[model samples]
Target: MPWIRSHITALLATLLVATYAAATEPPLSLRAVTAENNEPFNIVFNGKLQGLGVDVANEAARRSGFSLQTEALPWARALETARQKPDVLLFTVARTPEREDWFHWIGPIAKREVWLWRLRTRKDVMATSLDQAKQYRVGTSHNDAATEYLLAQGFEQGLNLDITMHDRAIGYKLLASRVDLVPMNPLSIGAFARESGIPLEDLEPQMLLISSGGYYLALNRLSKAETVAKLNAALVEMKADGSLQRLLEKWQPKGSKARSPSSPP
Candidate 1:
């Protein structure tokens, strides 16, 4: 009877180990970066950081029982830090083949559409097709994925500018008839124009450049796989429960309507 009991105890212990491996694991810690003064996507308010990407990251942390620490850094620097530090993460990154191997990606958090926009007064810039728009100079951000794509396609990159400088420069050039077109995201361009006192009506979409790929929460390669896996599971849970949709609507820019499941580009 004693031997039988011993055998049963050992079997139970093995099963427990297997169950533990399959269930939700314990908490972990993560570091994330955002712009020093960026808003709507990630921002600091009342001494606390909060925004769409922040909310998503916090939710993921809570569901996974992890602690999140966010810091404000320049866009290019933030991405570089994430790439260099094993503990760091970057959000809302547009995934590309070149970046696919850079980190462990965990999402398609948000989506946007890139566009070629021109001043309404610019008659020569009007185009029925992307090929036609290629004939004109398009203002773009240096080191941006859109810029890379445009360059690869033989579209002449005009007035290389940083992300922070692109808006004002683009608007001035458009109004002064310097550059033929400026490539930007619709929602972002609209928001910037309104904030800077530029009339939105003056801008017209020439051609849809490409479907902006969804945003992602990426982990550095040196980060623990178990930690990343837990966060990933949390994301899947959020997506299934419609929490992600509600978050998107809450943070989306004014006058921009939410896309339905049935809508086409």
Candidate 2:
């Protein structure tokens, strides 16, 4: 009877240990969403999602002991879904004052400069200052932070602001002279021109909007604090180890050298 009692106590101790481990373990699966049509950052190629943001996030999730699944959506819809759903992840989002409190901020995986763009041939259109830029119609996408900055500077819809849901359409409108200016990254010049069926030399940066703005991965506000902490730690380790920099170099655009992962091109 004494030996039987000892065996029962040992079995109960084993069960408690297993239960405690399960309760304390972090979740091993995650869902993330990104904006479509953003090449080299969050684009789909050959039916698979692969880009700088995708690659960086996948590596970070692996280091954090999690598996990540990603979906590509329209920019505004992706922003909305990540905000509304608990634990959802969004990546490569510009860190702006307007968006600072929307989610738990993660690493600034990439940095890019935004500028007002125009046709290279349009020498007559001058945007020497923000006020001068306001005199001309500017193309913008829905819920874009750069657009928000312009609005804060007094650009009004249907007046100087030409708004659209498809980001590529803004480039097309700029090509056709429907809008005098549009916000763009110089790095995207070749890709956008190709997508718009124009020559790469057609577009040029008119005026700088955001100089080296940081873009980060964000998790929903409802995510567990531990989840945020794990991801944050993983990104920090990756940066420190130079693995993040090497990964960015692997995806660097053709004909251009890669810059530091934390620095803008």
How many clashes in each structure? 0, 0
TM-score, candidate 1, is 0.78
Tens-digit lDDT string for candidate 2 (169-218): 97788878999988866555556667777676666667777765487899
Residue pairs with clashing backbones, model 2: none
Give residue 61's lDDT in candidate 2 (0 to 100).
85
What TM-score does candidate 2 reach? 0.85
Stretches off by above 4 angstroms in model 1 are 1-28, 37-39, 44-48, 158-166, 257-265
TM-scores, each model vs. reference? 0.78, 0.85
lDDT, candidate 1, at 245: 84
Q: Name the best candidate (by TM-score).
A: 2
Native-referenced Cα lDDT, model 1: 0.71
lDDT of candidate 2 at residue 125, scale 0 to 100 = 92
Q: What's the lDDT for residue 48 in model 1?
A: 79
